[model samples]
Target: MDIIRTISKGTDLGGKDPDHIVELCNEVVQEGHSVLIFCSSRKGCESTARHISKFLKKFSVNPQNDDNEFSSIISALDALRRSPAGLDPILEETLPSGVAYHHAGLTVEEREVVETCYRKGLVRVLTATSTLAAGVNLPARRVIFRQPRIGRDFIDGTRYKQMAGRAGRTGIDSKGESILICRPEEIKRIVGLLNESCPPLNSCLSEDKNGMTHAILEVVAGGIVQTANDIHRYVRCTLLNSTKPFQDVVKSAQDSLRWLCHRKFLEWNEDTKLYSTSPLGRAAFGSSLSPDESLVILLQFFITLIIFEATAFNLVEILLLL
Candidate 1:
């Protein structure tokens, strides 16, 4: 794995810089390999894909109409039009030029269309959000970080490494280049990050309060660990015990149990000397909602029952909120 920084003069880029990106992508794809371009936002990804498709149109007069190897991509796009996402006309035209974009704003089927098109080489250039870097296993010959930021915040070294890891296509490419596209001024910081060693790992259970609370609730609710001692024993048999101190894990588990009890998510079984989940708490375990989040939602449900009459608007609004 190699990390290289590409410093470009005209990179003070606004939305119009997709043209420059498409040119770079063209050079990479010409080598008979795919290019994955990472954009900071969904809008940026769409813009880049448009520029790529437009640029490719200049070189090939009838790229889309040709009997392309990946015929599935055309059918996939047609299927996407039926999806509730209401396919963009630009996207409809761009995929045929062997270029597309993927982002959360696109529905699951729409994103699937882009992924399928790219994987099958129907789409040579794909511009996508950080979701492509982290969520998907799709790799390309060249992975371009158009910017060092994902969304509002600038990415850190750890995230940048994960993105870079997607550069090399395994089995096909012997070596991978992790290219960081940044301004000339930012070169030193980028290089410094590359040179530095990664930091030691820490358990999120000890750090993320919301996650810890939810996990603890699951344990009691699922009957995984009934008591504080059971919680400690469970933690001891896990990988976290290797890095974290034993007593600390037990203490944290105890604290979490107490918090859950206070939240009314867990009931103390005095006779059994154990903790169990209440109905409201068990409901949280079965949901995507965190323990704290579910508690707020549950309390609100009770409050609404007491405070308001089941009027049409109120009922609709409450259901919508859920």
Candidate 2:
């Protein structure tokens, strides 16, 4: 697969021309190839897609006066026809063509619909968050990254290698093109990272196995376990095999359980020999209720309402008034 990596350091599109990116995307789409643009977050992805869509629409309708007119009006019209009807009423009214937004915040059915459209070649461009990078196998002829840095840290040489690796799909494209929009300095760094070989993948299997083992002993000791004991037992019996020193494993597990109890992450009852959820433990287990929510609930339970004027009244003054 052919990979093309571009770098831009400018933080905002206003600093650099957005039309250049949109034009490149149009060119790729006109060649009957799909494109995927990655942004940092859901909001960023949506905003970028919206901006690009507006530019594309303006380009398609007024091609001569317009800067971006690689694709014909007919193609744009076709794209509009294939767009999701569930979009906001205003957006549905003024439908744009050849582009769509995809992210996790969208409903499962909505995501599935976008995937189906993209796979069928009905949708030419997809702008999404990096969530699509790891799991989904969607192959785009061209992949554009608006921002390559992960969070506050500048993407180091190693990170650049991983991001670039997502470019080429094994069998889909003869060569895949990956583009990164960054400043001139960042571009140089990316080039250096690309020249070096990527490091070997780190294995987390050992850590996960140890964690499961610890969880099992914690459950038996009547302490809260992050995951269910049945899951750990299944992993140990079926996947890990009983090859390790059982006594040592048991001792480590017990130690971990005791530590958890001491930390108030879990509570231990010697008499009942059963693990019960503490207030903190319940908050941890219940996905619907967050720690903040639990705190709010507790506060509401203990605190009674007071009149605004009560603060001005001393104990003797309040008693005299009563």
Candidate 3:
């Protein structure tokens, strides 16, 4: 994936920005290549898509665009247009030229429709949030990142790799190209990132799992919460779980509890159906660790010992279970 750092107008001077973005996209897209642009938010995604679609439409004509491909795209959009309030004004105008935007704010059905068209090669240009970058396996000839930060958090190297990985379609694309439209200030960092290799995957279960585990322990230890219900209440206050139903949140907590018990970090009393942290659990808690992470570290250490002393395949069996 090619990471292109846009100069002058992109980030250093704010107002003249995005217009230059549209201009750049115009130059790339008109050459018959599709571009997937990742904006910072859902609103930015919508706005960017609309802006580019409008500019492209001056050269776009209905009922004829050289083939039947566009006709299929229009029909897909028309179905949305005819439903309820129909397509948004932005989508209604843009979809005619095989362009659209995607983000989490839209309904599942709405997202499915847009994604289907893009996959069918009916949608040529797409503006989307980083959600699209991580959630699906959609590839485009070119990827243009309009911003480095999404909301308050900067996109990290792992995420950059994940998003850029969407660039080339296997067999279909000779090679995928990705562009990072950043200010001159961000150029060095972005270039340094390009030279680095990706580290091993850490299954960060929804934004700082280890941190959340420690926070939850703090809440419990501080006497702020005495029951699973209280734990669920606080967890629901978090951004990741805020929109999730309380029942779902509680179920997840319960699963974590069971996992802790299985890890020998917590004791579950069958007769009373009560749960309490064991010595290991308390030790892990004091050190700011989740039972799962602690188990992983312990396993790694044990494997090292076994590599020098043990003759049994116990480590292999344990790894298989994990």
Candidate 4:
């Protein structure tokens, strides 16, 4: 990754300059190289892709310009048209120029088309959110960071390495290059991060993160843990248990189970002294909803039902108001 050359558009700028990013991408594409731009959010990806496409439109900078019929582009368009998402308006405008955005916000069909075209080297300039860093194997000759962040917070060494690693792939390119756009004041921090090793991995099931509740819910819903002893046994094998005292782990597990039961996600049998997932619990697990989220959904559902029964308003009207 290249970090020595810091381009300054003006003094006192807080973030990346779009003009510089566009110019840099244009130069890379004009040189017959594919580039990937990492954006912080889905909206950022879309906007950056559009900006690059517009800037490159003035000149014949597209690497794929030699294809008169744009056969690959046409095939991609056909696939999107036939899929449920149809042809996205932004994609319809940008894909012809070998540019597109990839993010979770796009439908499965849309993401498939973008991934297929980009992998085949049809789409030269691709913009995507940080999720793309680890989700797919589509590498590029050059990778550019619109900003040195995944969101408001600066990226850590591990994330930086993951995104930068995509710049060059074995048997794909002669060399790989990555560029991170940051303010002049951030150069030192960025350099330190580049030189530093990744931090040690840690468990996210702590009380503050609230992952334990979800974890306990999954096991119970899946019938993996049926009784209190089973719950304790499962907890004993967790990383959380290794880090915390056994009694503490047991207490947390009990709290999670109490919360789940109170939420109608679990039922206890006094006769057999066993625990089982309730219908609501199974529904929550199947939908992958967290405990708090499921509670909110359940409340909303009941409120909607009450509104439907107490008034003459149609379901659509009640939904719109809610």
Scored by lDDT, the top model is: 4
Report each candidate's C-alpha RMSD, comma-separated, in the order given.
Answer: 7.9, 10.0, 19.7, 8.3
TM for every model, in the order presented, reads 0.68, 0.51, 0.55, 0.59
Model 1, 1-322: lDDT tens digits are 3545444656532235533676577666666678888889988888778877876533223457455544666687778888887767878878777888888887787777778777767777888888877678888778888887889877788888888887776786776765567787877777777776778876667645445677778777778888667887778875557877888777777788888889788899899898888887878887867877886887899889766665766899989999
Clash counts per candidate, in order, are 0, 12, 1, 0
Ten consecutive residues with minimal summed lDDT in candidate 2?
87-96
lDDT per residue for candidate 3 within 166-210, as digits (tens), equals: 878787787788777777788888777767788854433343464
Clashing pairs in 4: none
For 1-322, candidate 4 gives per-residue lDDT tens digits of 4546655676222135444877677667676778999988888999888777775633234535556438768988999999997889889888887899999889988988999888776688899988888778989889998888997889888898889899878887888998888888998899898898877766677898898889988998888899888988898889988888989988998999998889789999999988888998988899999988988999999999998777855766889999
* Positional deviation of residue 102's Cα in model 1 after best superposition, in angstroms: 1.6
| Winner by lDDT between candidate 4 and candidate 2 | 4
Q: Candidate 3, which ten residues in sequence have the lowest lDDT sum?
A: 10-19
lDDT of 2 by residue, 1-322 (tens): 2454443544242234553677767677666787788777777767766666665523233346233332333344444445563444322322245566777776665566567666756566788776676677678888887786654556666655555555567777777887777876676776775677767543222334445333443343343343445334534543223545554444555555555556454666677554555666455445444333445665675564344345546776978989
Tell me how far the alpha carbon of residue 47 in candidate 3 is from the true structure, in angstroms, after superposition. Answer: 0.8
Instruction: Count clashing residue pairs in model 4.
Output: 0
**Model with the higher lDDT, candidate 1 or 3:** 1
Indicate whether candidate 1 or candidate 2 has the larger lDDT. Answer: 1
Task: List runs of model 2 lying over 4 Å from the truth.
Answer: 1-19, 57-96, 157-163, 207-322
Model 1: per-residue Cα lDDT at residue 261: 89
